[model samples]
Target: MSIKTTTLCALLGLLAPAAAIAQDSTASTLSRLLECKLTAAEVAAFTDRINAEDVQDFAHAGSDASGDAALSLWKSDAPVTAWGETSDLVHLSSTTEMLLAFKVTPGQELARGKAIVDRIGGMAPRPDQAAMEATYGWKGMDFRKPLSDNRNVRVLVDLSYSPGWVTVGCAYGDIQ
Candidate 1:
């Protein structure tokens, strides 16, 4: 809402439809969907919602994985299980920013991935390149969403897996 921006908008107003101005949405809009200040219970609920237990049994193993970072939600180096099978590394990070490698069943990547995004509020662009990318062998993806309409407060999601390989891994995160 700055003066320069306002003036520019006004000048551009006579040339474009108001719908064009209202359609100015970006990836940053995704940030507002994250549940900030994630807690253990909340994290559990989040995992449960996605139907994955992120290394709850061995969340804190070996040495200090956080390095005195003072985690707020979930733990680091946890063994996350997809669809309750084959324990893997933590997909969801514990911090201001995050990334959730959502677990899914065979051939469930596209549907499952969409479900996660839908839970938050469908991604921007409805069905864009991300969908086309998913159509390929790799059912993986990465995206960013900034909070409060500010690019500074960002959230990101990354689908981790291999090409031409069927695996249970959908990633989500908050961009730092």
Candidate 2:
């Protein structure tokens, strides 16, 4: 090959692997976040301030409403010296769903969390499945286009049953 072609080929070869690595890393990060398994140290660091009562309620209730209540109490007028349970990661089928709450600080925490969810949701497949489908091993769902006004901060995740590995839906709304 000519010198120019040789150099171009070498550059393309270098770039191809880098692109593949980036895609793989993104996929891996999504997988890990979906799994939602926190190390002992990570748990301690992230949830030390979360109240025992809050965690108990979330574990027992296992509903978005319960999460909202806990979030409200945490964000009450009293100083929040602690972080509420940030996420309750639930696994159904071969996929993981995460319920996250942040003790908003100067609004950054909530905004950051929203951004992350949006990014992940964008990668999910269309016609999203429902939580019931994944949990009960029912058929998958095909969602209509995302509602234009459906902006919420709470994450509602559904993993696909057919592919059985892709995240199908992630919805968010503000804690009401």
Candidate 3:
């Protein structure tokens, strides 16, 4: 199979729900991107922090217990770690439109971010949901090949609801 096909197949395998033969390819892709393992405590802490802070810029599917629990898991155990000058969690209309921005040292930041992305997975834009109002951008400092000088990486998560919840993340590193 081609690389795209292989990726889609792997994604489908990872996200196929029990007893469901049919799968949403988009959902599968999104889920695979977010497949980073997270600890329950970490998820809980992150969720609690977002909740307490009342971040209303992102869309949250889980407004209930299950959602809360999932959010807790996502926050705590996920591989996407925050680095220098990261934004506080914000709520958007959908996950796809939300962007994660952070500053890091040039040489290591992209690798670090890529590692996180590899662990977590990729996301695509949702067709049914409303897009985000804000556009996310990053600023880079000290440009260099292989590792740019002090720069910011911006990750945009494209979330779509396949009658369920799935989040996909895409990152643009070494923003200059």
Per lDDT, the best of the predicted structures is 1
**lDDT tens digits by residue: candidate 1, 1-176:** 99999999898886565434322211111112133333334434544533354322323222243222222223332233332223222323332333323234546655554554455452443235466566764334433333342322122222343221122222234332
Order candidates by TM-score, high to low: 1, 2, 3
lDDT of 3: 0.31
Return the TM-score for each candidate structure.
0.32, 0.27, 0.21
Off by over 4 Å in 3: 1-96, 121-176
Per-residue lDDT of 72 in model 3: 19
Please list the residue runs of candidate 2 whose C-alpha ends up more than 4 Å from where it truly belongs after superposition.
Answer: 38-176
Superposed by TM-score, candidate 1 places the C-alpha of residue 104 at a distance from the truth, in angstroms, of 1.5
Better of 1 and 2 by lDDT: 1
Indicate the worst ten consecutive residues by lDDT in candidate 1: 24-33
Sorted by lDDT, highest first, which candidate order results? 1, 2, 3
lDDT of 1: 0.34
Candidate 1 residue runs with Cα over 4 Å from true position: 1-34, 38-89, 92-96, 125-139, 149-176
What lDDT does candidate 1 reach at residue 78? Answer: 28
Better structure of 1 and 3 per TM-score: 1
Q: How many backbone clashes does candidate 2 have?
A: 7
Error of 3 at 23 (Å): 35
| Candidate 3 local lDDT, 49-138, one digit each (tens) | 455754233224344422322221112111232322123222232222222332234345545444544553342223322323233322
